[model samples]
Target: MDLLEDYRRATFFFESGDPLGAARLLEPIVEAEPHNTAVRLLLARAYFNSAQLNGAEAQLRVLVEHDPSDHYAHHVLGRTLERAGRFREALPHLRLASAMKTQTDYQEALRRVETWLGKNSAA
Candidate 1:
């Protein structure tokens, strides 16, 4: 299949709640188009949804490193770290995401991480 077809299929799989299928399809696309941020983002989401925290983190880190102002990347990275039980590490990314975009999800994540950090610091 062509790249576009693969991308469409991967997206369909992801949206249909088959993240592993999406990830499997996306892996080759990512290898072929390393700098394709859109594909990378989708692949990252696939990894995130499939509970592949390490892979998600790696992809998100690359996205954030390439574009610090990418609110979605920051938000996903923060969520990935949070899922890994790294609240303190997730805090800055979550805050940055909220600062870059006024999304309710980002704000909620930032608030939750902040509360966790605050409680931990107080202890």
Candidate 2:
């Protein structure tokens, strides 16, 4: 199969919510496309869903380093930090996520982020 087909099939596994299957299929592709930011991000997210936070964090740290302005990466990292009760670390990412938010005007994600940050700071 063509590379696109392979990627599509792997994506199908990923979208089907089988993170391990997706990870298994995508790991090799990663070597061939080391600079594929999207792929890296997806793999990181799949790791996150699989409860492999360290693996997810590793991927995300690379992505974040590559593009410090990517709010989605920051958002995912923020959520993971919150889950771990690392609120201090979560604040910056959450703030970045808020700044990057532009869709769903009613969401007020920035406010939420700020609220969390404020709450943590207060404690």
Candidate 3:
């Protein structure tokens, strides 16, 4: 199968709530296609699910820089930033995520960002 197909399968596993399976499936593909944005982004999501926050953030940084208006990228990037204690950096991405869609997850993430921002501002 092609790398893109492999990546798509990995995403299917991830969406089905098997992130470890997705990560396991994506590990080799990432080595083979390091510059593949979709693979990198999917790998980042798997990493986040597996608690590999640093790895997730690294991949997302590349992804967001390559395409700034990738709302999902910014959403994941916001989650990664918040986990890293970079609350300020997470705010804009979270806000963008919220503005880009009306999903419950995005709204929840945005709410978390706002709470963090409030605390930060008060400090």
Candidate 4:
């Protein structure tokens, strides 16, 4: 199989809003080129978009481990955890991502997680 062609098609599928299709195409590419950060990130994004939270968390964890300073990876991991109702676990990652960068979304996620934890803790 042509990896480049597959990557392009996967990207197309992702951009076309068929995240499951993108994920299906990306799985093999990620397996073939595990070190390709871009491919892995895209694959993680596809998983997240497709509501495959576990898949997204796995890929994002690898990305974070490979590069601790990857703000986006941390942010996505936190988001995945939050979506899966693991708010407490998502806190540190969201905080780290917010600290690493001043992106609005990152800060917003951090705040949302904190709120969830607060409300739940008060229960």
Task: Please list the C-alpha lDDT of all candidates, in the order they appear.
Answer: 0.95, 0.75, 0.86, 0.96
Task: Say which candidate scores most in lDDT.
Answer: 4
Per-residue accuracy of model 2 over 17-97 as CA lDDT, tens digit each:
888787766667777787898888878877888888887788888888999989888888876766666667766777777
TM-scores of the models, in the given order? 0.96, 0.78, 0.77, 0.97
Instruction: Give me the runs in candidate 1 sitting further than 4 Å from their true place.
Output: none
Q: Is candidate 3 or candidate 4 better by TM-score?
A: 4
Model 1, 29: alpha-carbon shift in Å?
Answer: 0.3
Clashing pairs in 3: none
Ranking by lDDT: 4, 1, 3, 2
Least well predicted 10-residue stretch by lDDT in candidate 2? 102-111
lDDT of 1 by residue, 45-105 (tens): 9999999999999999999999999999999999999999999889899989999999999
Full ranking by TM-score: 4, 1, 2, 3
Q: What overall lDDT, based on C-alpha atoms, would model 1 receive against the true structure?
A: 0.95
Q: List the residue pairs that clash in candidate 4.
A: none
Residue-level lDDT tens digits of model 3 in 7-85: 7889899999988889888988988987788788888999998888888888888898988888999999999988888
For candidate 1, the 10 contiguous residues with the lowest summed lDDT are 114-123
